[model samples]
Target: MTIMQEITTDSDQRQPIITLQGITRSFGPVQALRGISLALKPGRALALVGESGCGKTSCARIIARMDRPSTGDLYFRGRQFTSSQSSEDEKTYRRAVQMVFQDPFAALNPVFTVAHHLARPMLLHGHAKTRSEVAARVAALLASVDLEGQSTAGKFPHELSGGQRQRVNIARALAVEPDVLVADEPTSMLDVSIRLGILELLSEIKRQRNLALLYITHDIATAAHVAEEMIVMFAGQMIEWGDTRTIIAEARHPYTRLLLSAVPDPDRPFVPGESVEFLRHAEAIRKVSRDASAAIEQIGPNHFTRSVTL
Candidate 1:
């Protein structure tokens, strides 16, 4: 039972910019995270999928340096980082990894315009100096996220739609020129019609900036849209993980199957009384998935699923 297994896609062979080895977190008597290990490589996105209270955001916070692991080591570019790191090193790590929070409106300053939100980070990170330079960088950031700089930048967060505000949040994250982007439920708050657009925007940003992206969400279906790789987590443990397409096509874990089953299939129209059966099956899967196991089985070249005691 290896605690750390090398998980890489065929397209991404480059070294991981960030790595988490056997990470665990505890809140007094409660365990928030359990033996988490994964790597985030540049130019690729890894989707951390799980329902609420499954430690997905905990992983993101650890990677973004918002919280420290109760156990396990964190590595940046293969070098182990510590809480006692020098101020310079801390600053470098913070700037290198930026987060796009779940609530787009709350993430921004209401008093300030969209341009202010984007330009402040650029100037603070030394990406821009003069006023003209800041303006240019702000416009460029907005443009990269598919937002029109002239019309969008001057508007307040309240003035924009849910999806547009989210785009602005992403642009603000990019303003720092971060190597790693941790997006926590980037589109869960937006309208369903616009969710795919945000997902596409994230995919494009990952490729163009060559960013090591950590996309956190409970929706497994959307994970396939943005991430090259995926990890399905349950009860603070990774139940299944691998290439996104592989897991979607052939999910081995019961919990993974339950999640996929919940996704509405256009081909399978709703039938009366099916919901009751699904709830019963879903409960059974949850009971089995709650039991943790250190052992894992390889399902494909890059895919793996935990050994569940059925």
Candidate 2:
């Protein structure tokens, strides 16, 4: 299957909610993103996976409109969003694309109650008007994320666990009825046991709301759970990407294979000096992956990988 075919997954023929074409972001001499391109269609999730400093957050920032791409075109509903857009248009785009940050605690206001956080967005976005209407909407939003409306509301951020706080952040994002949801490592700050719950919540919300989701994380293992398609980034460039199960089952790039190797094997017993050997192997993979090349090799019907320069 091609990207277009994959885009029409589950037989949905809707156009992509957002598309990034050859996106690049530069900070003076340093380039954070290199020719990044992907399309986010409604009712589908795309996972962006890579190690730290591999431009995952940069891509998310550009998608969220928090940062502009140095070069490249960003299209929303097939129309390019240019710098000349009116403030109202910009606001509309921002409202349509909501982001859930990595730091759940920082995303919420400690002084405000959960009701206040969820109510503010709905009120500002005209989703609700009267106080009663806002309250009802807030309760519905909290309930959607599996939080008990009456029990969870009226509590401050410090009063909630990391997982609960992240759920609240998600509810806050959904309060605006966004068309796209960008979750940048939403579970990284929470306990390991609770991470799966957050991922499940995101997947459920995406399917239920038909919201295009960009699930960005360094953890490749979680990609298979929440996303149908996946991209592996190395040194700011996409080295391999395609159908999540296809790539996960038959990864082609060295970096991609390295990432898979890094996933902990519960059945394998620890061997002495294994850590040293693994680190050495990782360094070797990184060295070759860093050698930039624009050559892309098609690996399968929907799978593709960058050609490494030896």
Q: Give the per-residue lDDT digits (tens) of candidate 2, residues 163-263.
A: 99999999999999999999999999999999999999999999999999999999898998999988899888888888899888887787887777677
Q: What's model 1's overall lDDT?
A: 0.86
> Each candidate's lDDT (Cα)?
0.86, 0.86
| Alpha-carbon deviation at 204 in model 1, angstroms | 0.6
Q: Per-residue alpha-carbon lDDT of model 1 for 64-183, expressed as tens digits?
A: 898999999899998998455898999899899999999987998889999999988888879999999998888889999999999998999899998999999999899889999999
Q: What is the total number of backbone clashes in candidate 2?
A: 0
Per-prediction tally of clashes = 0, 0
TM-score of 1: 0.94
Off by over 4 Å in 1: 8-11, 268-279
Which residue pairs clash within candidate 1? none
